[model samples]
Target chain A: MSRSLEPLLTSRYGIEESWKLANAERAGAYEVARQALTTRKPEELREEVKKANIRGRGGAGFPAGVKWGFLNRQDGEQIYLVINADESEPGTFKDRSIMDLDPHRLVEGAIISCFAIDAHVAYIYVRGELAFSVARLEQAIADARQAGYLGERPFGIDHAIEVYVHSGAGAYICGEETALLNSLEGRRGEPRLKPPFPAVKGAFGMPTIVNNVETIASVPDIVQMGGDAWSALGQLPGDGGVRIYGVSGHVKNPGLFEAPVGITMRELIDDYAGGMLGDRPLKAVIPGGSSTPVLDPRRKVDAPNEDHPLHKWHGQSEIDVPMGVDTYRALGTMLGTCCAIVMDDTVNMVEACRNLMRFYKHESCGQCTPCREGTGWLVDVLDNLCNGRGKPDDVDLLVNISNNMMGNTICAFADGTAMPMLGMVQKFREEFMDAAIHGLPDGVRHDDSVRSMVEGVA
Target chain B: MAFALTPEREQQVDDILTRYPERRAALLPVLWLCQRQNGWISPEVVEYVAERLELSTAIVKGVVTFYTMFFDEPVGENVVWVCRTLSCDLRGGKAIQDHLEKKLGCTAGHTSPDGKFTLLKAECLAACGQAPMVQINDYYYENLNVAQLDRIIDAHAAQGGEDAAAEFSTCATFGAPHGSRGGSVTSAPPPPSREAVRLASQPPPANDEKGEGS
Candidate 1:
């Protein structure tokens, strides 16, 4: 609920028919884009973004301006800009909101991004499940083109641009920049090994800058507000811009919440989402999406549990931190995608971990050995733990498998799965122990004969 | 080959191919068209897509196999994706899946006996706020409980694929909203998006003046 001078992404979220282009323009949608293209040089525009220090909202938190700087301007290749609309991360639905509610914001943002990078064409690889959002975005593109916001020297830019929305066939790995490039090129959605990173070689061997939808969507606002002005909004030096945190799970008013950097996870849940649903005591929260390490803020921030291996590895105690890239990284977790998932008293952490792992196991592109095999192994062990067939060392073994998988894949996918998996096993070892022999912890309602494998049951 | 794009669909495929510099880049869209027309993408459809896109069938097959949404085998008339991710599961996604399984008389990834529905537990449809939702064919039924889902199933179970669409029905609203010039493309380059045709049959509004008398 708390935000800066004005709401950015969610400013027109709830307004009826805000997705329409005319309404969006009436609400000040394309002005910034027009200003950027007409007034500012491409380098100036990029500098404004760079000065803002706005990190990628798509989980990586890589600075957008720096990413644009990677474009090989002198390469003489047709530069490409790909909007990673494949927002397949579990619990992350913020991109879809911008696409469904204020698609012009995204299109304008894409236009500005393309202009900044000097790219002629951009593609939005929409998630297959987001049929409505895609339809809405495609229509937005057509509208923009019809209105001359895109194509053939519109807005007084010398270069014309075309934006297209392509449907992703449904794979979470496709959300990865490299994997997305492969998918975009009509290949299997597997991570292309880096070193020939997308900036150097991407989308049919062209200089490419693939950015998250939210990241690009913020460009228009940054250009209008100026970089220094925008950066000044953040609580920290590098932290600026309003991040649309998609709060899901046990929160009372689960929806997209746009707040500036350094917004504490507590404020996001307690104030914005109206706290835990049904007035239940808080248990834990996935600080940023399901992939980020789950934090147990509900537990008192007591002395370090040295006995816990993760506590020993990270050398951190039971803690409290704000929701930001640096803070999460301090906890050995990433503020991935700004998808905050809340868990309250009634839930079981072991089962929750299993649910998360199920997504990872299913989404692994399978080109990498560690993620393909290790994730399924993690799921099976968690399944055994839930079904009362686990050992005391099973949690430790889970941690071991996670450690082995980290940094050993074509993508950070193994680490994404492993880091969070390690967090669950290390932080909630007791819950796994309880679930192993004694069944689910007290207070959870479940059938005695049911199993906990992600895929076994209907 | 068991199937081929009709001359109209072939033109549509060519239109999609023109969007990309390379023909192969239209792979996914062409496959979507194939799946839409023929309930699932079979080997023949894959080959047909390969021929249209100028890619090898091996490449096409690899792409299809990687994505979970591409059904290689035949599916029922309607496919139900019940989200069983963390948010939805916490907010009764499992119970919704269970309810759907019982109603459809099949487990996840299985087709019903009557060949009308296939219930599958999807990872997340990204409608976490509207937890425990399902996407039947293209229309998303969100904020669902067992009863709400049951009513939807009853309304949709008997309908064929052609009879169902992502019910934007009003041409004016659908086209007017996104600036699509009333849902169909005014440009001669690519054909109207599949959505234009699929959504054209949207039922008239309930309270509209035309619906009352006409």
Candidate 2:
């Protein structure tokens, strides 16, 4: 279904000068922040956001209002709102567009969110490699400051805001909330232990609110339009606002598709992305980012057949399940980042898994032994199996190792790495077995995808 | 060689410090500013940064090594990142890597002989939708082919470009994803099944059958 009214996050993506301050202001950029800052109470703004059911777009989809409530709310301690622009999750490119095409939207939302949480300052810790995005966002921030949209006392309001943008030195883990805080603090970007969550003690031991790029960029809309209107955009009650989905890999017309959170994968592929690249039969789909499990959409995704207790907790099937956090959780996976990667039959599952494993193995912080060691072991075993010299038990052996690694590390990084392996070993076990017992799966030829380069030319 | 930031850059570093309540917070940005000037974060630069932030050199070194962006050694005049991840892999990222390695006379993470280019195989730069994408300094050359990429690089080399990262924007440099010539052609699809594949799908061979001797 087409989105009613204007697209909240990407309303101006296609327009010329959408990123410039003049165009954004002409299109009503900071009006909500202006009104909210001067006319509305901070708590009222938070309530409106709470009513809108806005959730974190940084993968977890944690309700943003609930997260804002976690701020100590006391008068003395300083509160900080960190924008997670470190969009490193594989297959997820939705946030980059906002940073590139519409930086003012984020600036407006960050200002409104700072008011809601009573945070005087906000830091956007951008990914180091995203120098292009950083440059655009920095220019946007400068323009906003020059216009008095930022800095101490805006438009005669008593409230003050100072915006600063920081760059992350390339670490995937920095996308994690605690790890992001650690990196922002000029330390190693390692995930911190929970219990003293970031809401209570974060970013130099202050009560901080960390949000994803899309999550904060979505705030101004809920404020501009009433909360009920925003929530109605969701596929389900309490489903929050629309999500920015990235459809990539093996799919024709692959790009950003904005829709309600619970839109099914089938619709995303066929209707939005123009189906598979050559209309080939699908092998599998990563419903979310690399951290989430893969879905073998060709078969039933019943709960009882799943390899974890996730189904027992929520109890549902995922074959045609709506793509949302709770629905995915019920299906023994997560709706993280909403970066969908569709695989065609020609792909060798073993090599795909290896490509994914190498990411985790390289990204692990070594803060926990299980993650540091377990990831390396998985890579080694996959190398052996995919490169010849694997025992048949290797697939099952991997399953066993992944099971041990899940929930046993300091952070969810271990589980995030393990879940995909679990998905590959469980759903695409035959392919893994083929690599071990025989060789690459039939029809999967020439390990190097160099043929892609030639085909694009010839 | 002196491991010092220029007066204006030092002011930029000091300004970044005011954003955070602590002095240590400026370490990363300071190091980045240094890299922007020096092309790499050398040992003396690292020590200079450590001194500036009041952090131990070991601590600064640890911080530098932890993040991938801060280079320990000099890079080429331009750094090109060819994505090497699942979506890119499926879209032939490996070929782009091989092509760049061949053209630049350097493998991934190596500078070219003329020091004009440094090629790196990066992990998921978050442009999956534009499969087979490369970030050259600041601008993205997405949905690329060997021919199109060759032209882009040749144009840049002919211009004798410096790092455009600080001033680059998508609206300016993203000329077009692919060049005029070429279609996505493929060899005939592999026949659906094979004899060995069919045999392996049968109930797993009893563990005892293939073991014991080994």
- Clash pairs detected, candidate 1: A59-A337, A289-A339, B169-B202
Off by over 4 Å in 1: A1-3, A298-320, A442-458, B158-214
lDDT of 2: 0.77
Candidate 2 stretches greater than 4 Å from native? A1-5, A73-75, A301-319, A442-454, B162-214
Question: Per-prediction DockQ scores?
Answer: 0.19, 0.24
Error of 1 at B178 (Å): 20
- lDDT per residue (tens digit) for residues B90-160 in model 2: 77788788888889999887899998998987889887876667888756766666776686688667764
Kindly give the number of clashing pairs for every candidate: 3, 0
DockQ winner among the candidates?
Answer: 2
User: Local distance difference test, per candidate?
Assistant: 0.74, 0.77
